[model samples]
Target chain A: MRFFRQVWVVAAKDLRAEFRTKEAINASFAFALVILLMFSFAFDLPVETTREISGGLLWIVFAFAGTLVLNRSFARELPNDCLDALIAAPISGAALFLGKALANYVLVLAVELVSLPVFSIFNNVSVTAQFWELMLVLALGTWGLTVIGTIFSALTVNIRLREVMLPMLTYPILVPALMGAMQLTSALVAGKPIGADNEAWLKMLIGFDVVYTAVSLVLVETVLVG
Target chain B: MINKILYVLGIAALAILVWNIYTIARLPEETRQGEVFKIIFFHVPMAITAMICAAVSLVASVLFLLTRNFKFDALAVAVTEVGLAFLAGNLITGSIWGREIWGIWWAWDARLTSALVCWLLYAGYLMLRRAIEEPTQRATFAAVFSIFAFIDVPIVIFSIKWWRTQHPQPVFWAGGSFPPDWTTHFLWNMLAMALLGAVMMSVRLRQEEAQRELDSLRRMAHAL
Candidate 1:
């Protein structure tokens, strides 16, 4: 219980800080919005095709902008040397990682909330009917990303050109999980028959989330101490 | 003595290469798709040997992480170097073979795509090592990254395979059916390449040790 509290405290610290500045939320949201608008311009495809492709495009924007968000994730701690302070504290590295990831998920999910609606408007599709189902996919997908991204951000936090290194270090490993997200989103967008098919994808997302989170929690300590 | 073994391995691997060339070059007139099929022997061996390299690196990385031993890191660096080289050869040869059979330079076949992902993962691993300067920390990070990357391999294969079945069908199968003699050739070539890969790993490990020794000597002289 105390361990969970410690994790929540770490996340609360981030959320409190982020709520004050809204730096990650505002930047990532705008970046995703612009990318969505650009795709709207460059594509010029018909509405049916646009709707079909929009799922992928939506995730791509989120992904590209996510690099920026995750880059600054640890950076927010660096100006005040908060990261080092956190490392010095008696907090479990895994708990710290989970807390940070939780904060990031909240922030990225906020970004998604802002832009996904705009994406629907620009592409002339209504997500209202499938919004809850879509959100479930988004939540699972974002969970996977945040858990992995937090660890990688820590890995590259002290390195030179880490902003670049973070993405290169991140995206390859994220592919399998991201692939799950893309497929499920596609099915949701296309309004396909979804009982077994989407279930499998959801299962994959859960599996990836379970597997990576478990392993990364164990490994995060090594990256954190340094 | 080890150097002599490496020499034998290198020579034997080369001999297999020559024998492969001879067999393909001397195929009978009525043989179907005669010379084009030759690429498979090299392609399969390189891919399998590349996998061996990756597996070795993963194990070494794990050992380094647990033991915090620089020696394991050295072996890891050697294996990664050799593995990445073999993987590059595999990708190129596999693509050419794909071209021969599928008439395109690339196809998003599950196996090929996962191999590409594996290559990217290792490439990133090397880059991660270069970016971190501290000796012990670098090894730790590299080891953790290798483990993370290896865990991803199965997920990649699974996700991509599932995606293939869930999505549109495009005849993504790229390799042609193989003959019995070709399988024999493949096994021999793979054995030879694996032997050479092991040799390269040991040689690189020795070089790493030498360089570390030299580095320590330089530090001592500087201290003086």
Candidate 2:
């Protein structure tokens, strides 16, 4: 009961701050849009190639922008000694981590929702028919990304060169999740039924999320306290 | 005393490695591969050495996480550094061989691609450690990531086999049988290479222990 209240407090605090500033969301959305435009110009305007590559391009854009958001989420907490107060509160470390992860998930999802339509428009691909499946993949992939990224961001927030090091350290470990997400997205864009490939990717995503979350939860206290 | 023993063993290992290189140089040039086949003696052993080092680091990481002992963390970092060195060797030698044999420096072949991924993953692990200021946090995070990243090793090992089954097989796996004459020498050199790798890791681990002791003394002096 107390843990839930603590989680709600932290989550509400983050969401309210994000709502007020809109700094992270705006920057991420803009960054992703620019990437889509760059992709349009770099690849010849052939519809087939555009459709085939858009899924991967979209994910890469989100990943790059999402790093900024995750970094800011923690950076915001650090200033004015907010993180010290949070640490002093009677919250389980796992609850604190989950709350931050949930907030980041919502922010990442908002960026993706806005970017998806723009991606379709620029790449000349139709996502209207596969909206629900694409949403599912995006949700799962973003959840995995946020869960892993939140923990790592917090772990590295205290370090020097953190802004640069966070992505370098996080991206390689996130490869399996990224690969799974890209495969699912590509299949949906190509109109393949979510069969074996989807199943394989979904399983890999779930496994990655569970393993990293469990390990991060166990180790977060160590990282935070030390 | 230990240094003297290590020096002797190190010299003996160097001698054996040189002899192995000489034997490979003397082998008749293959009709098809020409001189490029010589790379196998170096490239294959380097990969095997990296794998051995990675496996050792994996064990050390798990033990460190379980025990929360700092020594195991040192062991993990030490082995990973050695592994990265050998991985570098593998990549360079493989590239040279590829240039001579395939007429290109890189082909995005499954083995080569996976080797690159493995290299990047461990490099990230090392960078993560360096990024953190606190020793305990560094060790904890590094131990966790090392174990997680190691899941890619088996995937790399089997990728060529799986990709061959799905796509057209590469020349290396086409026959699916070891050339009989090459097998004995290859296995012998591989065994010696593995032993040399183990020896190198043991030496490095001892050096890490000394460094850690030195660090502790420095901290103590500062506290005073």
Candidate 3:
């Protein structure tokens, strides 16, 4: 109970900070929107082709813009020496990590939510029937991204060239999650029936999220302190 | 004494490598693949050797985290660097094989994609090591990242395999009609490559230690 409370407190703190400035959320959403807009020009295909690849394009946008939010998550802690203060606080490192990851999840999911309708409208892909299934994939995929992005964000925050390092470290580890997410999203977007085939990817997404979340929670202390 | 051992090991590796190359060149062509199949002599051994290096590095990373000792960190980096090189070799050889056999420079086969992704993962690992200036912090961060990276490997393999796999099933040891001597030849090549990898690891580990010593000396001088 106490641990959960601590996690919420840490998460709420990040949320409050983000909302006050709105820098990360606004920038991320705009970046995502811009990427979506630009991808239309680059591909400039008929509706069929656009619908075929939009799942991959959406993930690409999420991935690129999500990095912006994750990078800011820890970088913000540096200016005020808030990271050290956070460490000195009574909270456990796991709580701190989970909190940041939770905050990132909410932020990235919000960007995805706003971007999805725009994506559907722009691409002419009707997702009405698959809306709920798409949401399930979106939530799972975003969690996987945040758990990894948040941890790698913390890992690279103190390193030189962190802007470059964060994505480099985060993306390759993200390949499975990204692959699973892209596959499921594309299937749902194509209006394919959800079946055992999709189950494997869902399982992969859940497994990827669980394994990394547990591992990150355990190792966040070593990463932050030692 | 260790240098002497390494010297002998290097000599043995060279002698075995020469013999292996000679034998590989003279070996009979596969009934189906003919000459192009010969690449597997170099390809399979390096692939196996790189996998061993990856396993060793993962163990070293875990050990470093547990012991908080820099030696394991050094071992992890050394093995990963050597492993990366071997993996690169394996990929190149496989590409050459594919170009001739599959008639494409590359295929999106599960094994091929996973290997490429694995290469990128370790490349990222080395890049992470370079970005950190403090020795202990560098090692700690690298080790933690390595553990995470290593854990991702199976999921990578599984995910790709689940998605789609067109890479031909293993015929090397699956009681394929290759003559009995083929196993012997493969084992000898494996031994040669393993020894070469060990020697390279020894040299890299020593370099890492010397570099650490130099770093500490510089820090002390700055302090004074």
Candidate 4:
């Protein structure tokens, strides 16, 4: 109960602050939109090639923009020494990590809500089939993203060139999530029914989500104190 | 005494490796692999070398985390740097082999993809060390991040391999079959690579100690 409260307190604080500035939300949306616009001209291929890779392009945009959200998540904490103040409080380190990750997840998902529709429109790929499953994939993918993003963001908080460093560190480990989500998204775009055939990839996403989240919970405290 | 023994072994290993090259040259080559097949002898041994170094670094990182000993941190850093060299060797040879065999400069095959990712993880780990200025705090972060980065190895392998098979493509990714004798021949080269890694790591550790000495001396000079 107290743990939950601690988590909520951090999340609530971040959310209240984010609600005021909405900085991450705006930047993430704009980034995704720019990528969508580029997708039209960047690929010299015809419609079929573009269609095949559209899901991948969207996820790439989201992944790239999510970095902005993560960098600012801690970057903002630096100015007023907000992270030190939070640590100085009695809140557990795990709670603080969860709160930050959850806040980033929400920000990524909010960007996704707008980007998905825009992606569908831009690419002319109808996603009416397996809409619910697509959402599930989005949730899991974004969760996986935030889990690593939060931990690495914290790990890199004091580093020089953190903005460049975060994506280099993250995109590598994002293999499972990126692979699983791209596969599922391509299928969803193709209007294939989501069924047991996709079990392994789905399990891949869940397995990574579980392992990364658990490890982050344990290590986030270690990363914070330094 | 240990350093002397390591140097002797390293020199002896180099001699044996020079001899192994003769045997490798005499052995008949595969039709498809042709001359590029020779790259595997270098490729496989160095790949093993990098893996061994990464494992050693991971152990040292854990020791640092447990004991908070700077020595373990130094060992970890040395091993990781040596590992990076071998990893770079592995990537270069693998890509060269890929272009010759796969007709492409790169392939999305599991082994290649995982190795690339593994390289990134450790590169990021090293950058992480540079990010923190305080020695103790940098050690703590490195220890934690090493563990985190190491965990990605198996998962990257598993996921990329599965992702490859699940969705079949036109890519020429069928594994190359080396003769059974090749595995036996790999032992000498593997030993040589390990010896090479050890020599480099020893040199790195010596440099680290010298730097530590310099840092303490500077502090002492300041105090006076």
Candidate 5:
């Protein structure tokens, strides 16, 4: 009961803050849309090439947009002694992590909801089938991202070149998620069944999310106290 | 006693490295790669040294997290710094080698790309430590990242193997048997380079500990 209250407090705080400013969501949405547009023009290739590369382009946009949002999410918290206040509160580290990750996951999902159809329009790819699989992959992948990103944001909040450092630190570790997402997206886009290959990627995604979340949960107390 | 022993070992290692370089220089021109093959000695050692340093950093970071001791954190940072230096050497030497051999300065080859990514990740880990204001936070976060970054090392090592299943066998892992002559030199050089990496990491760790002590004293003076 107490833990839920603690989680709700942090979640409510983030929700109220984002509702007032809307800075993070707006930036992420515009940035991702711009990337999709850039890709549409930059390729200049035939539809076949575009179809093949569209999946990769979509993932890239999500990654870049995700990083921007994740960076700002904690950047806002850190500036006004908000993080210190939270630390002083009676919230458990696990609850804090859950709250931050939930907020990020929602923000990322909202960005994706707007970007997905826009991506299909730009690339002329159909998205009727495999919608749920795509959503599943995105949800799993974003959960993994939020888990790692929240931890790193706390880590890099005090760093000098955080914008550059966040992606640099995040992306390489993000390879497994990115690869899993890309593989699943590619398979779905190519009209393949969500069979063994898709299952393999799904397994990898689940494993990554489980392992990273566990590690973050266990280690987050150390990070917060420090 | 330790200093004298290290000095002797260092000199012996340098002599062996010099001799190996000379031998490579004097080797008859290969039909395939010609003079570019000469770069292999430097490139291979740099890669090996980088791997050694990253491995050490991973171990030290894990230890630091488990113990919550500053010494282990210092060691992790020291090894990561050394790892970055060797990775830079690898990239430079590998780029030069590529230009001569492949007629291009850079290709999106699996090995090269993965190595560059690994290097950038560790470099970012260091930057994160520098940016944070608090000591315990810096140590914990940096240690966490070091562990995560080390997970990519094996993937980077095997990337080429996975990508080139149809190509001729890689020299390092061919037919489940080691080529005796090449293995001798490779193992010897790798061992020496690993030792050198350790020596550099130890020196840097000592410096980091001293710096931490200085920081504490400065804080105490401010408090007073």
Candidate 6:
């Protein structure tokens, strides 16, 4: 009970701070829009080809632009020595990690939400045709990214060149999940029927999210307080 | 004493490797792919040795976290570095084999892609170590990250396999009537590569320990 509250408290703290400043939120959305625009320019493909490949493009944008939100999750805590203070507080490291990850999830999801409409508009695909299934994929995929990106954000928080280090460390480990997400997203965007293969990819995504989140929760104490 | 053991192991590995090379030279060309199939002798063993080194490094990383022993941390680094080299060797040999047999230097096969991803993951691990200054903190963070990385390995292999598999299935031992001596030769090659990996790890471990000592001495000098 208390643990849940603690997680919520930490999450709410980030939300409040981020809302007040709107720094990471605004920047990530802008970056996401820019990426979408560039994709249009980079490939003036036929509408059919765009629909076929837009899933890959959407997640590429999410993965690249999502880093903006994640990179700041822990880095923001550094300026005021807030991370150390958080560690010194009565909160468990797992709670702290979950809190930050939740906040990141919301922030990244917001960027994705906005980007989806723009992506559909630009690429002439109908996200509304498969909104619920698309949301499920986005939520699971983004959660996988947030869990990984958040832990790596903590891991690289104190390192020099952390912005670069965070993605390098995070991306390779993210390959499996990214592949699963990319395949599923591309299919859903193309209005294809979800088959056994898509089912497997979805399960893989769920397994990735659960396993990574559990491992991060268990190891967060050692990583943060050590 | 350790140096003497390593010396013997080094000599044995060299002798076995030389003998294996001679034996491979005399072996009949494959009935199908001709002499190119012989590369499997090196390719398979290097892949096996690299996997073993990665497993050992994973254990060392866990042990370091459990015991807070810097020696385990050094072992983790040493074995991973050596493993990365062997993995690179495996990839290069496999590429050469693929080009000869499949007419392409690369394929998005499950095995090849996962191996490449594994290489990148460990490379990132070493890079993470370089970016940290405090020894304990560095080890802790690396160990934590290594655990996650190792866990991700199976997911990577399975995901890629499920996503799409194009790599050829094992053909050497699939009831094909090959000379029985080839099995012995494979075992000998495996032994040689394992010993070579071990020796390389020991040498790197010593360097890591020496580097730690120098770091501490430098800090002491700064304080004085």
The DockQ scores of all candidates, in the order shown, are 0.63, 0.52, 0.82, 0.59, 0.47, 0.81
Q: How many clashes does the backbone of model 5 have?
A: 5
lDDT of 5 by residue, B120-195 (tens): 8898787778777778878888898887788678867776664542212345654634345656666666766767
Model 4 Cα lDDT, one tens digit per residue, B1-224: 96787788778878888988888888887786687778778887787788888888889988887788888988999999999899999889878887887777787755676787888889888887887778888898888888877876665445445654321232223563656677667777888788889888988988887887898899899999
Sort all candidates by TM-score, best to worst: 3, 6, 1, 4, 2, 5
iRMSD, per candidate, in listed order? 1.5, 2.3, 1.0, 1.7, 2.6, 1.1
- Give the higher-lDDT candidate: 1 or 4: 4
Off by over 4 Å in 3: B156-163, B173-178
**Candidate with more favorable, higher TM-score: 1 or 4:** 1
Better of 2 and 4 by DockQ: 4
lDDT of each: 0.80, 0.80, 0.88, 0.81, 0.79, 0.88
Which pairs clash inside model 2?
Answer: none
Question: Candidate 3 or 4, higher DockQ?
Answer: 3
How good is the docking of model 1, by CAPRI class?
medium
**What is the per-residue lDDT of model 6 for residues B137-181, given as tens digits with 9 covering 90 to 100?**
999999988888787557434543465666655545668565677
Worst 10 residues of 2 chain A by lDDT: A196-205
Which scores higher on TM-score, 2 or 5? Answer: 2
By TM-score, the best candidate is 3
Candidate 6 structure quality by residue, lDDT tens digits, A1-226? 9999999999999999999999999999999999999999889999888887877898889999999999999999998798889999998999999999999999999999999999989877787666688889999999999999999999899987899998899888888788778888888877776687679879888999999999999888888888
lDDT (10s digit) by residue, model 3, range B103-162: 998987657877888899999999988899888899999988888888756743454447
lDDT, candidate 3, A1-226, per-residue tens? 9999999999999999999999999999999999999987777788777767867998999999999999999999998799999988988999999999999999999999998889888878776658899899899999999999998999998989999999998898888789888988888888875798778878888998999999999899999888
How many collisions per candidate?
0, 0, 0, 0, 5, 0
Residue A194, model 6: Cα distance from true site in angstroms: 2.0
Docking class of 2: medium
* Candidate 2 chain B: worst-modelled 10 consecutive residues by lDDT: B164-173
Per-residue lDDT of B181 in model 2: 72
